[model samples]
Target: MEINGVEIEDNFAEAFGIQVSRILITAATKKLALVAATEATGYGTSVIGCPAEAGIDGYVPPQDTPDGRPGYIIMICNMNKGKLDHELLERVGMCILTAATTAVFDWMDEPDEKLKTGQKLKFFGDGYEQTLDVEGRKIHSIPLMSGDFLVEAELGIKAGVAGGNFFILAENQPAGLLAADAAVDAIEAIPGAITPFPGGIVASGSKVGSNKYKFLGASTNEKMCVTLKDEVEGCEIPENVNGVYEIVIDGVNEEAVKAAMKAGIEAAVKISGIIQISAGNFGGNLGKYQIKLHELF
Candidate 1:
């Protein structure tokens, strides 16, 4: 299938189930809220090497937020409950709690899979910790040098899809980045999904494991690297393609992932330098859901 003269490859991006926690960080201003959110979600890109995969879902306006302040909503995902719990505890305590005028809250409620993040952090107040009832909902607050830090006692964690990805093949580096920028912008508008990769683009795509270094869990994807097209045995890089960029998505469900990919691909192909649209996966080994590019339209 062709979109704006760009060929859409007859391939799919595989996704799998994982647990996620939706965390809300609010502050007096958007810039300060971002500072805490950025620090909290740092070092969290992929499950391959990091403790969790996380990103800013979107910015929430003051009117829609519980605290009536500008803030950011983020999602942190991991394979199991224990890992998610540990990551949230560490990141929230060290990053968000330290920021000025910042407060934490559970954006979503799931009784069955709740983590006592605020309950755990309250101990930091020593013997002066307390709970307050705000709008009939009780939240824990801990004393700090700046003031009291308020947090929702329990955070929801439930199963969600991860590892959804697509590739942008372009004529050159600038063109590839242009397509990627458009793709990222399109995906950003959709709620319940996020591109966990840095700036929503992966320049160095990786394979499952290293060929020479056994200790390394992942290695560079040589076939996708245009510079090594002539040297690699199974190079997928076309002669006209001088660059390739990948966008990886994780969302609240399969439909959210599909929607994000659809929007991104549609926008990307409309750009000037995009050649062909494709996807990346570990064959059938990565995940169960396969989102075919052509079928998305």
Candidate 2:
């Protein structure tokens, strides 16, 4: 299939089921919201390298925000609920609460589900923590150096899809980057989805294990590395394709991942130097669900 002069290949992007948490970081203004969001999502791209995989879900308008300020929605995925709770407390307490004019809120729609976001972070108040119920939602106000930082008692958690990715093969680095940028722009507009890659692009993909190191869990994908194509064993890279970039996405569910992937693939395929779109998988052994690109398009 062709979309805007770009070809959609018949391939699948495999994904796995993991625990996810959606968080809202609100501030007095949009600038502060962006700042807190950037920091909260910083150093979080892949669980392979980072402890967690997180990204900006999207921008929340003032009307939709809890504190009536511009806000950003972030989703964090982990292997288990305990891991999610631990990372959320650490990142929010150290990063979001410390940021200026920022307050954390739960993005969950339900009230009863417990994830203990504010409940755990309240310990940072050193016995000065206070709680308030606003609009039927419980929020904890912890005093800080600047002022009180409000956060919800519990966050939402659900089984979601992770490792949703697509590879961009191009004639050169510039073309590959351009295609990846366009894809990210498209995916960012889709709700409940996030591309956690660095600048929404991954230049160095990894394989499952290392050839020499018995203890290493993962290593670089030699087959996709252009520089080492000639020297490395089992490198299947094509000629004239000097660069490759991967767009990895995480979403609340399969539908969300499918929607974002469709948009991203469509936008990416339109670039001039993009050659083919492929996906990353461990021979269908790892993830619970597999998304077929051809079926999505």
Candidate 3:
């Protein structure tokens, strides 16, 4: 199939099941809220190395939030339950709690499980923690030098899909980067999904394992590398295509992820110099969900 003159390869993106928690970070001002959200999601790009895969879903208006303050929605995902619990504790306690005039709330209305993150962090209040009823929801208020930091008693965790991705093949680096940026911008409008990589673009896409190093869990996807097109056997890079960028998405469910991929691909193909669009898979070895590119249409 072709879109806007760009060929769409007959392939699928393999995704895996993961647990996710959506949270709202609100603060006295929009700047503070964004700062806290960014800090909380920091160093969370890929689960292969980072403790979690996380990113800002979008910003919320003051009137729409629980605390009547400007805030940002963020989603954090992990494959392990213990690790996700610990990550939420550390991120909420150290990142959001330390930020000025910040408050955290569970954004999920219905979750598969609940983690007592705020219940655990409440001890830092040093016996001064007070439980308050806000808008029919229980909240924990912990005193700080800046003021009181409020958090929900428990955070809701739900099953989500991860590793939904697509490759943008372009004639050059500038074209590829521009297409990737456009795709990320389009995905940002989608609800219940997030592109977790830095700026929502993966410059160094990896495969399951290294070709030379056995110890590495993942290494450069040599077949897709433009620089290695001549040297790597079975190179997927098309002739005249010198740049490629991958957009990795994690969503609340399969539907959300599929919507993101569709939106991203549609926006990317509109950009000039795009050669083709393709997806990565490992012969059904990567994960259970095989999202076919053609089926998206």
TM-score of each: 0.97, 0.94, 0.99
Can you write out model 1's per-residue Cα lDDT over 1-297, one digit (the tens) per residue? Answer: 898999999999988898888888999999999999999888878999889999888999999888899999998899888989999999999999999999888886443478888899999999799998755656888999999998888888888899888999999999999999999999989888889889888888899888899999899998898989889998998899998999999988888899999999999998898999999988878788888888899
Residue by residue across 1-297, what tens digits does model 3's lDDT show?
A: 999999999999999999999999999999999999999999999999999999999999999999899999999999998899999999999999999999999998579989999999999999999999989878999999989999999999999999999999999999999999999999999989999999999998999988799999999999999989889889989999999999999999999999999999999999999999999889899799999999999
Badly placed stretches (over 4 Å) of model 2 are 109-112, 231-234
Tell me the spans in candidate 1 whose CA falls farther than 4 Å from its real position: 109-112
Cα-based lDDT at residue 51, candidate 3: 95
lDDT of 2 by residue, 166-271 (tens): 8888889999999999999999999888998888888778878898898888998888888988897777667768878999889888889999988998888888
lDDT of each: 0.89, 0.85, 0.95
Best by TM-score: 3
Ranking by lDDT: 3, 1, 2
Query: What TM-score, to 2 decimals, does candidate 2 have?
Result: 0.94
Better of 1 and 3 by TM-score: 3
Clashes of 2: 0
